[model samples]
Target: MNNRIKKIENNVQDKNSAAWKKLCDYIDRVAEDGSEEFSPANELGYELFSQIYTLPETISKLKKVKKVSLYGSKLKRIPPEIGQMESLENFVPYTSYSLHWFPYEITECKNLKDSTVSTRALYGNYKNRMSFPDLSQNPVRYSGETVNCSVCRKKMTYDETNQLWISLWVGTDVLPLLANICSEHCKNALPKPPENYIQKAHKGSSTLPQPPDENESFELQIKEYEREQNTINNP
Candidate 1:
């Protein structure tokens, strides 16, 4: 079997990086002007854009954006603050292979109805059976000042919270979400995962069981992705 699924590090935005400043500036413009769409790649240019490994917590300021297009981003994770983008509707992070999971808080975007994602790269995606990060071993971190319970929004600390993975419907896709809860009652309050998923919120570990993957359906897709990565790296 392949190696145990490792936890992908959350590369926090470097405040001193040019990419951060550019992205912050773009967000400022969007917040003041209000827009139906936001695409940082086009705004930051390829040079600075490639440096973006994750978005800022300031993403919550985009209160009026109806769509977010992060096609081909290098992001490893999205901040939980994205849940505050109440007007968000279409989320397009289609080719962002490094983005393995989302914050459970994303479900709070009541208007999000459509999304484009790289299913094979996502943790717990039915197409790949990618292993989720073993939260039991890896420490949980939050983008906010304090970790809050994903269910009831109760304030919590590292010593008081339990972090787990849950595959839930976000827009039209069922994506793996990281949930930080203060108590078992909050965990029990989590919405059930859809059919074909793990069926419950679970602390991810290598020993954690999962449904068998249909390798035949995704072999070519995986190979193609590898080829593209090879070309980008070798060229």
Candidate 2:
């Protein structure tokens, strides 16, 4: 498994760019045609990465698209508007190594059931605990032009926002989600993460205590067994 953290390209989406226009048009078509699946790479070609680093917020318009296939993309991030894809069910973005955490709003996709993500490349995968981008110092980095309380959905400014990462069940995958909140009350009320994952929301830090991987756990078990054998031999 390639466990090393990739240097994520934080290139902001330029709506005026050709790639943005192309993606917007695609979403418009899907919205009008009511397509069940929407695959940008197939429609835009393998070179789609060269044109865009992230999807357009206009993706919210794809009300009928149940499946989104972004296999093997170079996308750095997905827009918060993805939460508005009310019909989204199967999200397949496997091999998108640079794509790390997802927006907390993704939980709003009530119909989402199945997903295929690059687990090792994810921020808090059980197999590879990659560090999250620290949001304490700069919360706006994860938020959009407007900040809002992830829990209560109340509008707030970036100054009033408190960003934290929480790994919760999103479409059959425990994805590390970025939450920008307005108050401690909201933070306290956030849902508990799954077992063997970080139990609380936290700013991204390499020192954070996460569950050990299988290999590390196995090594510890071996050490314990060896110590027990040594004690028996000495006795």
Candidate 3:
């Protein structure tokens, strides 16, 4: 298995474990109380690091939660069902090193306001660049295998879909989100990415514009500083 999948598998939690029970309890509490702030990481005695993947279907039940924190968890992906949380306002997943991207369905949360993500760990992050998975141009349906469109959740065949990647700020932190769409129409329906990011979705490849070289950037800064010092002395 590749390193990414390996990391995910390593963090998978057993459903019957004490940690899972604690997570369940927390979820129930949030659901019952309709609490505005939910931070599973802060729960006492709950070792969340071992639970790499979240039960997205279970999380869909947190309809009344406004803020969700998964800081430092080992999550690999967010469930597309997160869009169903109509009341969700803020999200914090800072330092989740294994999470690479988000599902397009998160856009369904109209009230979402802020997000905090670990940008360095994301696919195609500006600071420590990483490559994104190449999406298939012609998605085909395999007998007995089904994949839903990331945007509409409609059943889609491999031949009928298109895949693309985009970076957007769901709350405060910018996240690289992936879209598996049924048609060009769904692709076009995606919202614009956050300011200072790529303006549109593009295929993941080396052809994408490269970020500025760190060494070159540092040299330019030094040059500017030297020019400023020279001007000060002459004046």
Candidate 4:
């Protein structure tokens, strides 16, 4: 396997390991006081967790944490268990380059108020416009590889799922996240993307709206400025 896939597999293994459980126990104790700050990169050694692609599902154990930082971790995904962090308010995952998306379940945190992300690395980012993975078709099941529904977490075969992609502002950045759902019920449970985005789940392809070229974007900005000037003068 390539280094990228290897890192992801390693992260998955770490999530299930005893060491990860120990880490979770530490965080859980700190979370109860709601005063201590947590920076996994610093506590765990940046070089160690930086290669991790996903956080453990034990993240839900931080029920009283008010803020969490995950700066510079090379994460590819976050577990939906994060939605269970009832006291979470601030989320920082700045510079996590490989994390292209987030789980829609994050909206379950009613107290979550702010977030920071590396927008440039995101799929379909406004400035970069990187294309998202083509998710209209279900991913093929590899022999012995397990596939689970993103929402329900139930074991499923590739043929038993439907794939959808949506972009939403989970905290402060709009992230393009993918969901492999087992049924339409789970798909409907997704919250809407932030206002002024594509406004619907879509398959990744050239058909999606393209960002304007530099010249075109500049001209559009000039026209917008002129229109605003006219409105100000007349009003």
Candidate 5:
């Protein structure tokens, strides 16, 4: 039996995916002066990335993006600074199955609402109930050193960064999309996170972790599942 599990055999390779190209094209047109709205659109949706190196700078300036969406992006981590966008209202990354957790800074966005996330893409998201990664140990120096995740300047403060944990109660909605958020503040601020999803702050489910070692672990787990399936078939 094939070891592949529902791998999307579509023509949309990461770099060549239609969504990736469109998002890149949009990003490229931005003036980068921080004065423009970072490509204002009535409805901005879908993001596909082959790597995480290009987001921080553009995200820092995308203060005007009110509606956004993404799916199965190569991004391993999202910055907490994303909460700074006060104008943000609708966020839709429904299929970005790779993003695992969020930053403490997303609570800053007082106006956030409406998200479209693929619940199956989160950590403990019922469908993929893989055990959540142990964050009992806070990360140190993920920014400027790693590409999947870029820590905010606020998280760079010596000693202060480690003690910081922000959780927000956004609201109550059964939005599987809500599962994508990783921060406490972002969750608390939500009008309501999806009700049917796995418990909040539980590392429900989603893509693999950011570090290479973690990816190796993910590969191992995948193999374990394959062996189990093989046993069932043999029986």
Candidate 6:
């Protein structure tokens, strides 16, 4: 495992999905376990997550692909268009420690069957300790905002009290954060995932993080929300 990590850390390609794709290909052929998917190894180095955070456009282009897997890529997010892959079936984003959730667009893949994610890093992950990324820092305008699912995009603002954080915990290892959840069905579908892992309760976008989910236990919990002020009095 140490050697594998070293290989991944040392072999980071240009920080794009294409570069990650090469690593993905190599893992499929060489992974000791023979699983087509493998986790990110030490081959990568500092700031790996920063390099590939913006490559969703490239990942979405592989639409014809059925089975997909990415490990140790240090990805911070998955493109909402990832749901555009109508042919998708199996997913293996195991060991992508940096990812925390998946965009609601993932629900669009009506045919998707299997998934292997890093549940710990997910926003609503078990025990919920991973740091949540600050939404305030994300640019309000982007190419995918207009073209992707309108509900999933975080383009509109509401009375801050009414605003809610939409999150999902799809995999057990790698939980790539989704853009947001803007609908009731999105919320309901999550309370009980159709397959794989068990469902845990969590707070919704409308709730305060300090209190967490006053209702139930969530499989993955978004422990914190980005606040305008660092402290709660300002929060």
TM-score of each: 0.87, 0.88, 0.72, 0.71, 0.48, 0.49
Give the whole-model CA lDDT for all candidates, comma-separated: 0.85, 0.81, 0.69, 0.68, 0.43, 0.45
lDDT for each residue of candidate 3 in 133-184, tens digit (9 for 90 to 100): 5454322222234557877688866566676888877676667776778877
The residue-by-residue lDDT of candidate 2 on 51-72, one tens digit each, is: 6778887888899889999998
Where is model 3 more than 4 Å wrong at Cα? 1-18, 44-49, 137-147, 157-160, 194-196, 213-235
Clashing pairs in 3: 114-171, 114-172, 115-171, 115-172, 115-173, 139-158, 139-159, 140-158, 140-159, 141-158
| Deviation in Å, model 4, residue 120 alpha carbon | 1.0
lDDT of 6 by residue, 1-235 (tens): 0011101121223544554565445444433333332223433333443355433344454555666756656665565666766677777767777555555567677667778776655554434433333343322233422433235444443222112234444432324233344465544444443222223323333122422222323413333333423467674
Window of ten residues with lowest summed lDDT in model 3:
1-10
> 199-232 in candidate 1: lDDT tens per residue?
8999887667787566744676788899999999
Give one digit per residue, the lDDT tens place, for model 4 in 64-133: 7778888887776777677788888898988887777776667677887898988877766666566665
Point out the higher-scoring one by TM-score: 3 or 5. Answer: 3
Alpha-carbon runs more than 4 Å astray in model 5: 1-48, 126-128, 137-140, 144-160, 163-235
Indicate which candidate wins on lDDT: 1
RMSD of each: 9.7, 2.7, 5.5, 6.2, 12.2, 13.2
User: How big is the positional error of residue 158 in model 2, measured in Å on the Cα after superposition?
Assistant: 1.3
Better of 5 and 6 by lDDT: 6
Instruction: Give me the runs in candidate 2 sitting further than 4 Å from their true place.
Output: 1-11, 138-144, 225-235
1-235 in candidate 5: lDDT tens per residue?
1111222111223455565456555655552533334432222342334433223534645676675555445554555446666677776655556654445445556677676666554443434433344333433233343222123232233333222222234322122221223244534544433343333333321242222233455787899999999999998
Clashes per model (N, Cα, C within 3 A)? 0, 0, 10, 0, 47, 42
Q: Is candidate 3 or candidate 6 better by TM-score?
A: 3
